[model samples]
Target: MKRRFFCSTLFFITPLLILACNGPSDPGSNFSSGSVTPPLFAHSVKSLLTLSVIEPADPKRATALGQYLVWLVQIDRNGEPFPVNAISIDGGMPAHGHGLPTQPRVTAQVSEGRYRVEGLKFTMPGRWILNFTVSSKLGNDRFSLEIDVGH
Candidate 1:
């Protein structure tokens, strides 16, 4: 009886003991890497803007909007400031949607590597389709991006 009990107890606890002994370890949990990798340019839509998507800074903390989002639309391959006349969300008309700007064209700043669009805000927690029309030296190029912002 004693031998049988001991064997049963050992069999049941063996896996538990092994799991406790081989517990997972957190390697460099407190370390921080300040720099981030740039987004990969998938391709250009027509001749207007180059489209690219980047992974979130931290996948675990990514929201529906995305981790870090930015749009880079450039005109004149020679790399000069292009005038962005109007921008809108979804496919709404400029006057109705009236996105980014309508008048004195806004030029995106090019620095380090990519062109930057500041304060691109997603209002709600859902999928958002952003459409932009940029008129520059080249012409008018329309670009769109679909982003999901989750709560």
Candidate 2:
């Protein structure tokens, strides 16, 4: 009886562990550029301005366990440049329940509605969520984006 119980428990537990490791957000596989279901590459929370990455075209390909720069363009609902006075960055792996490995920030404004993000590094291959807050004439708005990384 003890052996049968152990066998049944193991049989159920093994498949569950396998399924958990092979989930959509599995760190081993390379998923990027809004490829995840329901399109998580955009924002978890909406903002007055829409932020989109303009550089490193593919985040999964850019992942190398080092720092990198990511450029972003913020446009309004009408496709006009959002007047941004200040911007901040914060994000992390929600599954892991921690913040970004580094403190990334908006270093400069490349042009109207275009900003340069610096000091972004993904130490491990997994799903990461990035949050950006913009202070504009309208008000302070915060948004989020999910990116896949692999090294």
Candidate 3:
């Protein structure tokens, strides 16, 4: 009876003690969290489109604690400027399992293939996944990039 009670206490307290020392994690689950460095320019999963970040309208928006941000990017299909009818943005921290604090979207087509995205607000410093879905004349495709937000 004493051994059974001790075993039960060990099972429950071990996890808490481990977490008290440091948070628990699954190596496979957060594979991209701190290991991989995402590229500034990336190709779609199907390789049908190319997405490139022109620059942050203000460089500080990325590291600014509470400020919203605007971004300019160019989309290309087959290595040329690809105009799109619409672009939708969605993202979150996979480790935290929550979506973005704001619903960011493509505000305008700045020029041929260049687009303006706004309403990006990061609530915390962590590894965030930014996903862009492009809807165009040819077809629909998606671009995903991992962003390491700094404190």
Candidate 4:
């Protein structure tokens, strides 16, 4: 009976010890608690769609180097969740004239206007612009989110 109890205790404590030693699986999860700059407002005159980051609030400073999920929602001029037929996300450094290290793709439409983008990895620290093209029955609109990394 004692041997069985000891084995169970050891098994549970071993995993805890390993986790504590390694720390957070993704260190980038500790970035400053705030939304991206410019407040994620819409700029298009005709479409008037806005994109706001809902996860990793401060994308300017990532918590890890691997792929990360980017969550965003779109709103219309009336401040209501606006549904779009499709959305494409891409980014790059304007100065360097290059694109993002990873090709982020829209994985899902969480709701009417919310979206989840996966496979976004910033290999290096520099200025990055995330361009999003929103399309719907009405028309297609484009907007950009500017992120400054390693500053």
The best candidate by lDDT is 3
Ranking by TM-score: 3, 2, 4, 1
Q: Each candidate's TM vs. the true structure?
A: 0.42, 0.64, 0.68, 0.63
What TM-score does prediction 1 earn?
0.42
What RMSD does each model have against the real structure?
Answer: 9.2, 11.0, 11.6, 11.6
Q: Write the per-residue lDDT of candidate 4 for residues 8-124, one digit (tens) a residue.
A: 999999999997877877575677756454444445536466666666565443324444646555545467777888878797888899988777878888777777777777665
Local distance difference test, per candidate? Answer: 0.45, 0.69, 0.80, 0.69
Better model by TM-score, 1 or 4?
4
- lDDT pick, better of 1 and 3: 3
Comparison by TM-score, 2 against 4, better one: 2
Write model 3 residue lDDT over 42-145, tens digit each, in one string: 78877888998876633344435567887788998888888988888999989999999999988888999999888988788877889998888878888997
Worst lDDT 10-window in candidate 4: 58-67
Candidate 3 minimal-lDDT segment of 10 residues: 57-66
Q: Give the TM-score of candidate 2.
A: 0.64
Give the C-alpha miss distance for residue 61 in model 4, angstroms. Answer: 5.8
